[model samples]
Target chain A: MTERADCRASTVSYAAGMLREQLLSPTPVDLRAFLMRALRPRDCLVQVGGLAEVSYHGRAASTAEVGSYLVMIKRDGSLQIHTPKGVKPMNWQPKTDEITAVLEEEQCVLLASRRSPVELVRVTFLEVQMAQALELNEEAGFLLTGSEAQMQETLAAHPELIEPGLRVLNRELLVESGGIDLYAQDAQGRFVVVELKRGRATQDAVSQLGRYVASVQRVVGTGVVRGILAAPSITGPARKELEGRGLEFVEVNALPLVEKRTSQPSLF
Target chain B: MTERADCRASTVSYAAGMLREQLLSPTPVDLRAFLMRALRPRDCLVQVGGLAEVSYHGRAASTAEVGSYLVMIKRDGSLQIHTPKGVKPMNWQPKTDEITAVLEEEQCVLLASRRSPVELVRVTFLEVQMAQALELNEEAGFLLTGSEAQMQETLAAHPELIEPGLRVLNRELLVESGGIDLYAQDAQGRFVVVELKRGRATQDAVSQLGRYVASVQRVVGTGVVRGILAAPSITGPARKELEGRGLEFVEVNALPLVEKRTSQPSLF
Candidate 1:
């Protein structure tokens, strides 16, 4: 049965990525066929539940006794086995050189290995209860944000918090297209353009900062201006965009100062 | 597409044990009813998949951004969230005093708390994909074994390997019913009765040793005979049985000496 306690909350996450890759058929023939396909090298994540026996044969050898477990093969060529008892996987191997699966008799056998030092591991699945293979895309499909107006004000009050030896020169300074969040000067006397987001930032925010910096550069010369985007976190694509343009990212967790007396209380 | 490699084998396990535990029905009403059941305190293991936003509100206040994850609540009042990318749980709390689930506006809210330091974790599940809860029974329903006969020879040649100063007096020494694996004398010079098992030892093996020790005790007039069970592993019931009978368990991994040149090769 169960016990009762006050319903407090804890840290948790949700799933959103689309299931674009393989959906498992849960048979050795299907697994062999899937694994024997061309080596396209797309990101892959596989989960299978069954009886497994894992053994490694390299410089040092070790084997785990057989038991039912959830085996995961990640896209980065890493493998892990999760038991029912705890959070940590009962066994795991780091990213490696190669991973292959095949059918022998009615059983599914997986072989993973690394070169140079020559390490190898084999996993045998006696019976599969559930199996799924997913391909992960590095793109974040959703965005979470807070009040940008309040975020700019907070960082305006504490420019040094954004970067040491920085001071705000203007807030909402008008340019040709729109108003910049905060125009500032860096410690090295460089004109620094700052854009702040209360929550997760995206490529649109980065592009805005880049335009602001370009505007300042037109007046102060190209090499005299710097661009920085400050936010609690940023999406993967936004990070890539910032890196490509040689811009900087500063963390600003204080933007969400107002937890919105709006919105209903959370359910679990 | 999948790549090809030589299909070697690794350590794996299979599932057993009757589904004596609870089988879950996914619904707020059902979860509330199940969680509000009597405090029977049977071992519980739960697995739920969905979008979740986890936040901890205690001395160290923290919150994880919303994402998809697997949430696990274990029998001992422990809770964990597993992400898809790695072997470690993204977030976890140790054994706690209470864990409760309730529905608010169709959202499932979980509150888990510990008393001493007064730490609490709150998890809100916006949607549920796959959810199941099963009671974990410690009794292992199956067994694994090795070469018992070979194990006896390995230990006989190296009795000190079992315990320091242990010397074998005889192999398969006869008793009232049958033969003991190894008859030895300890560093203390008391008579020792040893039972050998190649793979996993069970309650039956422990009982056999108990009988042997009693036999030797009757012949030697009590308090002078010690019983030992040697095997690669032992079942949970056998472990409890050994402890209750005041017996010893020794490591004997040499059993499955012949990996059965029989049986077809593994499938995954």
Candidate 2:
């Protein structure tokens, strides 16, 4: 009996260990106190699974039916409501919006309001299941420096990299649908709609190029309007789509143009 | 000339005001030094527009084509790559991974590595057009407490709230596709599949309910399986879909089930 009890105790601790590092309560009595302690000035994601009624008053008034909710609060005071699927949030308020949480006798309510747009969102929790606070570390990932304009400039300076006979005509040429990255002429004098990507080109990029080609063809009439997708690389799916669409793909390497300043004295 | 200069000056400051409140640099000389200064322990979002190549060596070896990239660094050391559109990132590294940034004479490189599965990601920036960092403030949003399990349990205990003669037969009944939240028999003795949403029901939720009903009907063979979507409220589009599909919608209010203990002594 003692051995069985010891085994059970160890299992409980093991389970606790998995969650205890990030969570404070196995079960909390005061929901407000828990939130006050858990919520920090950084990013926090809260998942609620119970009855929740969300009411929003904005351009047009609407209220969400009571259901489970996932709430994400960015460090900049912006908040968004998410369902299980889809990239866009079911509902959201901008970073400038203000939010406050109030704990009543047996319910916890959160109120978010925006001034300029005059929007209000009120979320009421009928039952408390789990509440966890996580501190978001922003600098722990990659920071990139560069822009598409720089890439475009670099590519334009070296049109030979695209094809031997390709001659550049205009950059950011205005069309009906959108701006074409580059307008060029091929060796055969066929108008080429060049779509430049700073990274691996995806299927969407190919489709975008197709749209540009179609738009240009509509305006250019009889002259064969060819489409060319230029990037460092292209994905397999994107390549397949490009082939199917009879579009040409060219690999353009973005080499550093400026000479390294090795002669400079090390400040660090 | 003075008026022209004043207009130009105001325009410059106006553009500066638009970016300066969140970003420190009008233009930075050294990308690494700027990142070292801009990257804090909190959440920061960095967008770069130039030639960038991302290489990943992990369970599967792959590389991203050189292109403009949006790198988001969470406070937890996790990072994600975002393209111009799409809800999900092109690639991502989890918090458990380690990241390092190296500044070369003419290039800025970011390396992220993980051990357990053995993964490595290298992002090389050929040119930096724009790099801006914004500090995240987490406490500005709402914090919620609740769980779906509790809502399910409550509704199961009070089946009468759903309908007059509705009786809950089983909770989480396993079907071919997935588990039904609640299976019940209505007043007409017809089998009913109850899909409970703790918040506002969207079109996706209704579709999910429809799937459950279809799966139940396929299994029950002849007994008239009906789907009932129960939530605090339903969206206009969701209601329209529900009506078109001939499904019933019920609003279930999430009221506090327990009374408040006001007599207790306050402890802060």
lDDT of 1 at A72: 69
- How many pairs of residues collide in each model? 53, 42
- Model 2 C-alpha lDDT per residue in residues B227-246, reported as the tens digit of each score: 99988899986787688778
Write the residue-wise lDDT of candidate 1 on B1-268 in tens digits. 1111110111112233312223222355544544444123535466565567777644345566676666677666678866655556556787668778777767677788877766778778764444544433332232222346666888899887688899899998787635788999999998899998765787667757876786688788955788889877899867876887789998856733335334665322
Residue by residue across A1-268, what tens digits does model 2's lDDT show? 3432232222111111111112211222344555454444444333233346676665434566665454545445566654332334456776435666776556677677888767777777664433443322222233332345666787688787888888999999987556799899988899999998876788668767876887898899988999999887999867876887799999875434335459875322
- Interface RMSD (Å), every candidate: 17.8, 17.3
Q: Which regions of candidate 1 are displaced past 4 Å?
A: A1-27, A31-45, A57-61, A115-119, A134-268, B1-44, B57-61, B75-77, B134-268
Candidate 1 overall Cα lDDT vs. reference? 0.64
Q: Which ten residues in a row have the lowest lDDT in candidate 1 chain B?
A: B2-11
Q: What tier of docking accuracy does candidate 1 attain?
A: incorrect
Q: DockQ for each candidate? A: 0.03, 0.02
